[model samples]
Target: LPDVRSQDGFRASLDAIIIMRSNLYTVGRLIEAVMNDNEEEAMDCVKQGADCNQVNKHGAGAIHYVFTDLYLHPPLDLLSKMVANGADVNLRDYEGDTALNLAIKKTSLRPDNTMYKVVDQLMQWGADPTQKDLDGNDALALAENRKYLDIVKLLKKQKTSLIVPPPHETPVPSPRYQKSTTPYESRSPITHSPSPVHPDWGTPVLPAIRSSDPLIAPDREESITSAIEDDNTDELDALLNDPHANLNVPNSMGLFPLHVAILRNNPVSRNDMVQQLLNKGADINVKAIPNEDHDEGGNTPLHMSAARDQLDTVRILLTYDPAISPTNNEGLTPYNYAEQNGNSEMMRLLKEEQRNAERSNKSSTCVIL
Candidate 1:
């Protein structure tokens, strides 16, 4: 008898056998043999012209089946054999996720060490690190999100250096004020007034003035004090600009200028003056008044703005220093005020600002807007 292994004998044997017309079944059987680690049978079938990269009816190729099974219960040697035998390592399934992507998705299911080995194997077999699936997530970003620090380092090492454009310069606004054609034209050049009283005036008045003696008091004294009390903002602005003026000076009730502004309920002017003072290095954490009312205690400008529903002022204050706590003398925070007042819009704004601060603190994170 002729040798059964000879080409002529093999052809005769094949001819005698009933050949199936279904390529799908043949592909399934090929995958099954490979998955079962029947290396001899798999190699023999492939050499007989079974397509190694053929997809089943579900659009899953040979490599996909290998990857799926490997991640669930990896057979490294068999996977290596399949890779060496020309399995397409980057073939995507119907979901448009490649073998490597699937491997990454399966990483959450495996122990760290095993996942590392699987990732290394995939990378070694030409898995593109930059490839993204239907979800627009690249392997590197996924790795970073998953806290796979070592894998991220490896991917970075393999990646080409990216050429990023230098950051665009933010244009500085012009100093010249654009004149508004409004009915109320600014009466004077935007100039800060001078300090109202001499520094010594606050020390101690002479006994003649201090004594409530009617004979020594001048006729215009009461009118002058009343005028000063009525429109004292210009004087406060002047004092705020004075480098020599005491920042912590209280106007009678032991309230600083900031406290006086708050009590006066002049939020717009108060905010402007407060910002000016802050720009000049005013402390934000100082209590405005030493003793106002035990219950209605002193607060920082942030506390005042939030309690009074001054959203714009609150935003401006936060922009200067978001770390400024919203806590008041009554032990309430800014977030507490927003919540208690049922101001949903203000609450949303404060939360967004908080998130921005958090993002700023995180390394390697980019804010789009």
Candidate 2:
């Protein structure tokens, strides 16, 4: 049978929503629709009485998932719909992060400025630029600290009167996404405040400060990507320990350290390095930029690993984001890459993981961009 998601039309998925037993499931489907930019389907769900403000198991709403893409820019109109339907523009997720905050973090990882407009829309809809999370860092502070100058500028333009109260005045409900059996601990030493920046370069998020002279070493010698390629656990450990080290920042090739490790193909230590990076806050679904070398520009670590036949690395990444079905620039998923490579084991593992994710619906599972 053809996958319901790949159908010419959206029959199967809509059917799943109709038969869903819980409001939570209905809300989850709404998020899925919004993520895929199916406005008609999403509006139908909303009109059917599914709350646009419903928080999925991940402790986030449709707005939080909208900008998660590293490629395939999301339409700002979708966000407008959620807000129009009374979704909270400033509701914080389990991480105490609002949609604007998440948008700022993700935009820095990619070259596209589409999210800037999304942030602007959110601001116009009353997403408070000065609203702080648990860490006392507001959206403006995060943008500046992360060196998102454009976002900083946009945020600066907004006034406090634009701050809208949450549409649902009730207290936030318990997370629909289950917690991991292992208590999660963040390895990043940097908390939520705006991080220190290099005077001339702005913040170093993904901004590579190249040295003009070969003799002079850049202030920072090792990057998360370099450490992964060298398999230098010691350097990787030291790098992650710094609060300001950007784990999700892509290098010149738009590959995160996790992607580099997958391509490096160090059979003995690559898997270990992958695990180490994830533990230290690496994004399991971080993707590479599109280029001729890849089937599509937006290949994630999973796609790279499957294409290169790194079985162990594939296994490790799945554990972090069991339901990750991210497609590349070509609109092919990691599962497609595995099948194309004729890797039966990779195909089986991804299929099994997809089934399990459907059964359990790890709503708490979030891949921080």
Candidate 3:
């Protein structure tokens, strides 16, 4: 080796080595977080430049650990984050099991809907159910061997050839479709209509919203909706910063962007999305007029959050100055919905937030904008 101390390239060389070492350390931290099942730390490591696909001696990647059942329910949210960070879903461990395979295998430890959700998410994320493991059992075969009919049904329903189109294959949809990976998305074809128009579901959720301009185009709107559903803050920020994006008004569903953020059932990202929307000028007290959805009509985001038993969402909403226990068109407040649903946790959260709101109101000057 040459004496590089006197060379012009020495500083660059040292910086490169330091960067490499930092990356390796972050990767190690990611592994440690995975072993401990600390998704927050894992995400921290990912954000700090840890490679999501970095493997251990056993060849298990971060994706594998997210669904591995060493103990407790798997950190499936971490799996989504890992995939979004470019972790390959089909990558195998030493035992030749993909993340989906391991998730399906976990049904032996605890046969529940959690595993099903993981499996379903992995599939939507482009996991090949046909990929087999060492024992020659593919995802479907493993589900069948385990006698988990729901998984079997899910696998059977997914067409092997049609999950995602190849790059060379040109799609034939008229207006082009923007498919969403979230479970709430319907696998429906795109319609050739004006932006944000619903053919089957005629009219806006609220009559007043019918006059509210969509402002954003269909694909842009869908992308934003998908971002909200996934709690993808980076994507959401980009979308919200778009000149055409509108956060305050109701969509065709008679729901504002804030309402969608409130109703998402993800364990993570609920509060994060809410905070992002609020930062982007989302109205905290905007009422959702979900037409004919029973008493869901005239519900503020708080009422919707309480009625849906979204305790964390309610907690986040309360942090912003909002009307406490604001009644809907049904003459029931958020607390009433929580009580009606028998959600004790939600009720407690609403009660505490109401007290906090009261205290806040007593101290702060009420300035109408």
Best by TM-score: 3
Across 69-119, the per-residue lDDT of candidate 2 in tens digits comes to 622655566566667777888887777888778777674433323556667
Candidate 2: residue pairs that collide: 57-176, 57-177, 177-364, 190-243, 290-297
Model 1 whole-model lDDT (C-alpha atoms): 0.56
The residue-by-residue lDDT of candidate 3 on 1-369, one tens digit each, is 877665758788889999989988898899889888777998899888688777888788777776666646776667667778888888988888998898877744332235556677788888899888888999989876765544665677565334345789985543224433332222123243444446688732311212234422255565676688677789988999998876775544566788778656463677778888898788899887644222356888887776555666777888787888777887889888667645677778778877887888777966768
Q: Which residue window of length 10 is worst by lDDT in model 1? A: 183-192
Decoy 2 TM-score against native: 0.38
Ranking by lDDT: 3, 2, 1
Judging by lDDT, tell me the better candidate of 2 and 3: 3
Question: Could you tally the backbone clashes for each prediction?
Answer: 0, 5, 0
TM-score of every candidate: 0.35, 0.38, 0.45
Candidates ranked by TM-score: 3, 2, 1
Error of 2 at 152 (Å): 42
**Poorly placed runs, candidate 2 (over 4 Å):** 1-222, 291-296, 361-369
lDDT of 3: 0.70
lDDT scores of the candidates, listed in order: 0.56, 0.64, 0.70
**Candidate 1 vs candidate 3, lDDT winner:** 3
